[model samples]
Target chain A: MLLKVKNLNAGYGFLNVLWDVSLNIGKGEFVALIGPNGAGKSTVMKSISGLLPPKSGTITFDGQVINNQDCAVNCRSGLSYISEELNLFTGMTILENLEMGAQMLEDKNKARENLDFVFELFPRLEERISQYAGTLSGGERKMLAIARGLMSNPTMVLVDEPSLGLAPQVTDEVFNALRLLNRQGLTILLVEQNVTKTLKFSSRAYILEKGKVVLEGPSSELITNDHVRKIYLGT
Target chain B: MNNSRSIKAVEWLKSSGGITVTCTILVALAVSIHKGPYVLVNTLVTGGMWALMAIGVSLLFGVMNISNFAHGEYFMIGSLTAYYIMHPLKEYLLETPNSFLAFITPVLGIAGATLAGVIAGILTDKLIFAQLRKRNREGWLLNCFLITIGLSIILINLHMLIFGNTFKGVVNYWDVPSLALGDVYVSVDRVVVFFIAMLAILFFWYLMMYTTLGKKIRAVAQDENGARMVGIPVNRVYSTTFALACGFAALAGGSLLFMFPSYPTVGIAPLYNSWFIIILVGFGNVAGAVPGGFMIALFQVVTRTYMGEGWENVIPMFLISAILIFKPYGIFETKVRSVWEQ
Candidate 1:
């Protein structure tokens, strides 16, 4: 396993959000974590990405325990987190935002290489590089956010609700991009709301509710499971 | 492309950059009609110091959510640093006019004053603010303000104990005579002070725009969590930023020593001036402080000329109060770098 979590218990200062939650992801696996609002899906991503410290249990990434490590340390150690809020420096230009993303890439040559890759990943971003991010269209901003996450060229990417507040067509375009990245051998742990689309492409899926993992299995098997069909898929 | 370009142009006019250009033209026009070169130079000198001090307050508030009432003390520290070092070296230089020590003493004092402010700022952050940052951040803004208040009181009393109420100062740093510009004589000291202030501001601009640490500070300023996600060390950035802010305050204090003098309560007027500029800009932006400081200094000069010397602080306060009541976001623009900014 490239990432492992065991009985993780965490929350926001006395408000226990995650309860003994345990999960794993092998290298290069496309995994989906889906749940209702306030089901601790985002919290799980926050803890694993080291944005929120885990009160108990352990998170080991690439064979090293990474529990309670600073977020920057996690990013430096090959982990990139694209948050739901899409924290792109709105006051700054698209080019500057991308440059900030590559700040930790120690090797200037690799950072330059990644810059080319990012511009290529989203040609729209390249064209509008000089424009302030706040001026970008919704779809372009989402693309910029994802492109920023890729600037580090991380080993694993944890993307939380990349489709939030996006149109269905734009959402499809985003999912396609994610699918393309996953195909190129990037380990992806996605927390998404669109369950059917997520389960269809993700190799494995974890169903969380009330801050605990209630069900976990292969995506293909879980998609047909009666409990998931009733509560989540509305089939 | 033209459409987008126009949009960007419009955005620029709304930004701090646009405001600066507009204010410069207006001030220049007003100068051509009424104010002479001497008045212009005076405004610039006073304005430059205020800009340096106000920039620190604005950046600290915008980034760390700190309302540092104690910021004035850093200014005092600079004054003290320059006074102690410059006095003896200056005396020796005056006795022996051709000596190298006299030629370099002012520069050394200036450098020492800024360095002292930075050290004091960093130590304060590491010893006090760093401890508070580790705990829960609820009411964090209020807590920080209170702590600064306590710090201001403690520092002021400490200054009284050590330095007493002595008004230690210099008439000027260099012995060079004032230069005449269009029948108006401009003091060499004021010219030198303005030059240093501009240099410091430009250096600050370069640091914020170009350096890696500056990028981190800007990132953290915009969004701390976002910066952390990109692997920027937020805590260290905070400490460095605080030091930078204090360093500027110190620089301002040392540079303006000839005008303000060094005393226990000397910082009080400077503190008020900084707040006036901060409020006038009506934003949490460092860039706005430059023009805003100049604008306030001009207002002071005008009020001083008409109503004698005492109304300098009084009228500005009343005007600001009126502005706060009517257009609270700020008079120049309704910019949102407010401490209460969500």
Candidate 2:
């Protein structure tokens, strides 16, 4: 297993969000956690990424117990988490923003290589390299955020709500990019609301409701499960 | 491509870089023509010192969101540090003007002053600001202001108790003759101070522009949580930033020691002047503070020289108030982020 969460319970101040949420992701697997609004999906991602401290239980990544490690440390250790809001530095140029993502690396040549790879993955970013990030369109901004995550060259990527507030076509573009990355042997844990599309792309799926994992199985089996179809799939 | 290309020119003009250059050149021209070559040179020297202090003030304010009311106290501490350092070396420096000791003594004094300021700054962050931040309660903005104001009071009284209420000076240059450039009588020591200030400013500029630390500082300033998410140590950055800002303040204090009186309340004037420069440059823009300092210093020099000595203090206040009323976004067009959501 590349990442494991056992009996995890976490939340914000005075409001518990995740409860006994045990999950696992194998190396190079694309796993999706799908749920409705306020179902505590984001809280799970936050807890795993060390953005929020888990109330109890352990988050093990690459055989190391990393329950309360700082978010930056988690990032440096090759567990990249992309928040839903896509927090790119608006005042900086695209190149500068990418450089910030590659900031932890000691080798300048490696940083340059990462930069070239990001540019290759997202050519639009290269075209607008000199332009300030604030001016980029929604699709481009999302792409830049994902591209920045790749600059760190993580072992696994945890993305929260990649399709939120985007047009359908832009949504497809983002997922396709993630799918492409997963195919290239990067492990991914995705928390998303778009169930049908996510299930189609993911190798496995977990259905979260009210902070608990109600169902978990292969995407092919979950797609046919009656409870998933009735509640999440809106069949 | 064409649209982005066109917008790039507009962005450049609208950016802080455009205003800084334009303001500097325009002020240089006006001072030279109206105040003559001598006054222009004098203004540049003094303005350079004020600019250094303002850069520190604005950097802290921009990054940490603290007005740092004790900034003046840091300046006071800096000047006093230099005074005490020079006190023991005064007799030696006076007798050995052309000797290596003479040259090294002032350098030693400057370094001592800077180190003192940096220590004070680090302690302030660790003892006060860091505590406030750790508590992480609501209304931190107001809390920072009130705490810094209180710290300023404590520092002022502490300095009085330790150093007493006497004005001190480096006695080596008390009777030394000044070099003359036409009608302007430029003090040799002040000239050395000016060159050192310029070099310090350039060094700061380079650090912010091309360094990884600078990038981290900018990241933390833009978004603390985001920076942490990306693995930058936000707390350490805050402490370093405070130290750097106060270190620059000390540099200004050290440079101005040869020309200005060193007293317990000596920092008040520079502090007030830095506030004016920061405001005129606009908040949240560190680079703009440099040219902004130059603008205010020129105003003071010209007003005091041409109008009257009384007008020196009064003019800056009036000018800053008018600018605030009319163009509160500042001369560089920095956005007022608090007024409306983006």
Candidate 3:
């Protein structure tokens, strides 16, 4: 397994979100965690990425125990998290935002190469390279945020609710980009509210309800399961 | 494409060109009034020093989102260090058979001041600011403000106790006889101070614009949580930024000491003056601090020279207040707030 969470429990002050949530992802695999709002999807992502301190349990990434590592250390270890809220440095230009993503890398040439790759992935970002991230359209900002995460060339990517505020067409565009990246051998853990779309893209799925995983299996199998279909798919 | 191109052009004009034009016009006016090269040089030099302090204060606010009330204490400490060093060194260097030591005294004074500034920065962080950071409370700023005010009072009193509250001028040894350029007399110290201040500002500019550390600092300033998520070490950046700003402020203090005399309470005027410059330059725009410093310094010099000392006090107060009312973001704009939001 590339990443494993054993009975992970976490939350904000006085409010517990995750309780004994155990999950795992294999190397280069695409996994999805889908649930309704307040299902602890974001809290899981935050705990794994070291944004919030986990109350209990272990998070092991690539053979190293990483339960208590800070965000910077986790990022350096090749785990990147893109939060639902627009976290792009709004004051910075698209190019500058990408540059910041590649801040930990020492080689300028490597950074330049990554920048080229990111621009190619999102042509709109290339066109708006000098434009402030704040001024970008909602769809474009989401693309920029994802593009920034890609710049770091992480071992695994944890993307939270990419479809949150995007239109259906834009959502398709973002998912397609993620699909292409996963196909190119990047491990991905996609957290989303769009059940149909997430299951369509991911190989494995975990159904989270109120901080605990109620069901977990191959995405194809779970999509057809009566419980998942009724509870999540509105079948 | 055409519509986007036009929008981009408009933004470029709105953001960069307007500020540049205003600064140029003001500089030209100052030059025109003082036809003598020395007078112009002196004004520019003094302006650069004031700008350094303003830039330091602005950067602290930008990154930490906290007002550092103890910033002026950094300046005072720097000048005091220089004063202490010069007091004992002047006798030894003057008595030395060689004149070289005398020539090098000012450099040593600056070095001493820089060291003192670094120490003061570390202490401020470790003793006071760090505690606030841990509390996860916003009240640290208010606490720091009150603490600094109290610290300043104690510092001045301590200065009175130890240094006897007497003004001490940094002794000059270059004796290069002032260069006579028509009506203005230019001294070597003024010329040296100008170049030093310019170099310091340029160095800071390069660091903020081009270096990795600079990028990290800017990231934290823009969004602390976002920066940390991206793996930037926020605490290390904060402490280093504080030290860097204090170092710049100290350099300014040292330059001021070279140009004038120092007393325990002498830092009060420059501290007040820098507060005006900080606002006039915009809260977080370091680039604006340079011109803002010069603008205020020129106002002081010109008013003092032409309209007498009485106008020196009146003009800065009026100009700063007027500018704040009209352009609260300052002469140079910063990203701390959106223009549309305002």
Best by DockQ: 1
Summed over model 1, clashes come to: 0
- In candidate 3, which residue ranges exceed 4 Å CA deviation? A107-109, B1-42, B150-164, B305-311, B333-342
State, as a TM-score between 0 and 1, how close model 3 is to the true structure. 0.88
> What local lDDT does model 1 show for residue B152?
88
Error of 3 at B323 (Å): 3.4
**Each model's total of backbone clashes:** 0, 1, 0
Q: Which residue pairs overlap in candidate 3's backbone?
A: none
Chain B TM-score, all predictions listed: 0.90, 0.89, 0.87
Of the true interface contacts, the fraction found in model 2 is 0.50
Better model by DockQ: candidate 1 vs candidate 3: 1
Model 3: lDDT to the true structure = 0.81
Task: Please list all clashing residue pairs in model 2, or write none if there are none.
Answer: A72-B231
How does model 2 fare in lDDT? 0.83
Give per-residue lDDT, candidate 1, residue B29. 57
Better of 2 and 3 by lDDT: 2
lDDT of 1 at B51: 93
